[model samples]
Target: MEKFAMKKTLIALAALAATTAFAQSTATISGSINVGIMNTGASGAQTEVASLGGGANAININVAEDLGGGLRGGFDSQIRFNAANGDRNSAGAVNALFHTANTYLTGGFGTARIGSIVEAGTCAFDPWGCTGGAALQAGTGISALGGAASVKQAVQYTTPTVNGFSANYTSSLSARTNERQTLGVNYANGPLALTAINIKGSGNSTTDGGTAITDTATSQRAIGASYDFGVARLSFLNTVNKGVGGATTADFTSIGATVPMGAYTLLAGFNKNDRATANFDTKISVGVNYALSKRTTLGADLFRSEELAAIAPRTGTAGSGFVTRIRHTF
Candidate 1:
């Protein structure tokens, strides 16, 4: 009798625990992996073709608890790993190392997290899909100006939206150490959306051995917008960065459109990057994605970039590449 009662008690406790967990307002686990093969070709005598492997993987866990009185708090973390080489790289190092990648937090006025996190300027445009790609430094552009491969230590906050408008701000604590401050505002209504971000970095003055003083201070401003036209969506983005110390300034402008047909979507974009003074570089990409199922997609993209200049002669510079990928979500 005693043993049977003990077994029943344990079962009851397990059921209660499950009930408590389900009663919580929030908790979730999500992840995705994308793998693909790429063929690349460059101008001039450069190898015309080569096969390469590429992929991105990410896993995220989020938990939230209600604090009562219309206040709630939560924590979110993500681990991004490269399955190809079993390498983990980000703000933290091996496992989202840097302070901005894997963050822990608690809050009420909103929420605060410590670890690898994007600046407010980068996050403000999340809903409009401006938050990804090489242009956004989350992916895509190889030399994307914003985040790219750099990480920042920051504190950020987002204000509660009022009338379809929201704003955010992020500030860095350390000066001259990738320290950046940003402000952004977003508005969305019906089929139209707009986002604007401004970023400023404190110039670093320290250099190895002090042979020459280097100014690292720079500023960037960008605006992006998109409109849905039933069968297709049209988007435009423009960014300008002013370098310190008479260095060449850079500007990037992009325009693109996406059209949906049946189970496939076609996308095309043209971008121009003005390095120094004139239009020195330009890129064009076209992509098609076919949904094989609700959670699986097959896609291919072709991209080309060219350098136009007299001194460099644009030799050994122009390049073309194609990528075929399979992506699955779980």
Candidate 2:
């Protein structure tokens, strides 16, 4: 079943590509290579080797066409490779098959995308929307929890801008038999922007034996905004998730800032997560980047996280780490 699904997705992407090429008769290829090394200095920490002696890399290709009536369609894909072991980051093969990550159509009404990609909630709440760059939390964060990356079968739609405001909706259809939906509204004017998203998931709860036990429902609300002030930009994000029965509820909040000076930029951020059990965690990070040229940069980052639990003081420990990386665009 999974193979068939993948095949169908590929066919759709191929059709989209063909249409784009025929309509515009133009093609352009571009991507980036990022290499980084991470190191840790804490008690009992292992002296793991640092550097691109072993690293990961990503490549992407995009094709689009301009249609009449101000409409356009495109196909996008990406592949991640483990330069150390010469293996692909995805499942199945050494060099994973090129998967259509973003195949969509756009017009004056906005855009709609398909394939394995982020739901609308993340797009609305993330500081970086569809712009693929190091500024994205998923691309630069040291901890997975700091970035929410989920791939599911989804359909999304955005509305045309009205007075600098627009709305979006996304629905997920998966065999897990769960249905997830998200709605968001965005406003952008001058150097200020704001977005809010509400998400809900519903399905049948299963027991250990896989038997349906009860109806399960989950909901989340997130809001994020940023303001640019000439030399700096400040951003904040807040989210709350609610679950019933034996499920857990969670709340998260984050604040960050970026300042640019000449060819160098500074970034700092703080985030907190609280669970239903009252256990919480906090993370703080600071990073700096120096532009090597128009299309290249070198950066250094440091991050630390601490657990805060009343009953498990011993389980709570602080971790600090750093990474040095180089990014190049072609």
Candidate 3:
């Protein structure tokens, strides 16, 4: 009788342990789909079906596990696609099964991330959430890892927030001769948020036949701030790019505002790029969105640009355009 009781107790303890382990780990899948129609001022193709408002049609898979002792580990993977043609999103810019696959660990020591991690502060000030026709001109687009939004074989570390302030650093594991590095600091409290970042591109130099071969590198610095005033939220971003000799290559300034009125919200923005060659590119965008439910929205936008850079070669020149879209998340 004593032996049987001990055996039963052991089995009960084992079952409890298994249940606790399962509860401590989780895997979830979620994503959004955006589809819309667009008409632009481009010469030949002026009207088309595409994801409106620069929103993503993507699927996200996340897996996380508690490591105990104030530590946790996780992996996040995202796959983005074009809703119109069913092609991979940004195929020209990146060709891969997953747009991004990041592995990270978080704890009181802050967070450390690796793999094809997204660049920090890429489009924080973009009211369009950094994806589509509503994106700001590329001249001021901030990317810490080269010109793309994400870089492979990179690592990042962020310090724990203290008094609404924290710092972060990221660098690619590419060859040291031609590497990319980014450093940033952030502050957020109540209705105010601020960020500053510097991205540097390292050039290569070598001695060949007693001649000093040099490649000029460039660096970009940007500052962004936003404040929420209940009825309206306002944002501003300023960016400066410099060449090897500290010569200003370009300067970009943008201002944006969003107003909420119940289920309908209005957005507006203006951007200007000043090139060193005495040339300027400017753009203006205005849009509104109506929330049909917690997971669905309807939106429309009208925008015009003078020499606006192409968001993608396949999308062609945005120029002046209008778009209407339906977005749903699950």
Per-residue CA lDDT of model 2 for 81-137, tens digit only, reads 544354554322122344227788898768888875544444333332212222333
Off by over 4 Å in 2: 1-22, 40-57, 82-86, 90-102, 121-150, 202-217, 244-248, 276-280, 307-314
Badly placed stretches (over 4 Å) of model 1 are 1-26, 43-56, 92-114, 120-152, 175-178, 202-215, 246-248, 276-280, 307-317
Candidate with top TM-score is: 3
Give the 10-residue window scoring lowest on summed lDDT in candidate 1: 204-213
Query: How do the residues 1-330 of candidate 1 rate in per-residue lDDT, one tens digit apiece?
Result: 999999999999999887676457677888666666654434332322211221135667777776545555666665555544545533332233322343433343555555445554332222112322212223243222342222345567777667788877776665454466677788888888788888776532212211111225777787878888989888777777777753547677767777889899887777777763343467677788799998888777776655412235534355666667766778
- Give the per-residue Cα lDDT of candidate 2 at 325: 71
Root-mean-square deviation (CA) per prediction: 7.2, 11.2, 7.0
Name model 3 segments beyond 4 Å from true.
1-24, 52-55, 90-94, 137-148, 202-216, 243-246, 276-280, 308-319
lDDT top scorer: 3
lDDT value, residue 139 of candidate 2: 28
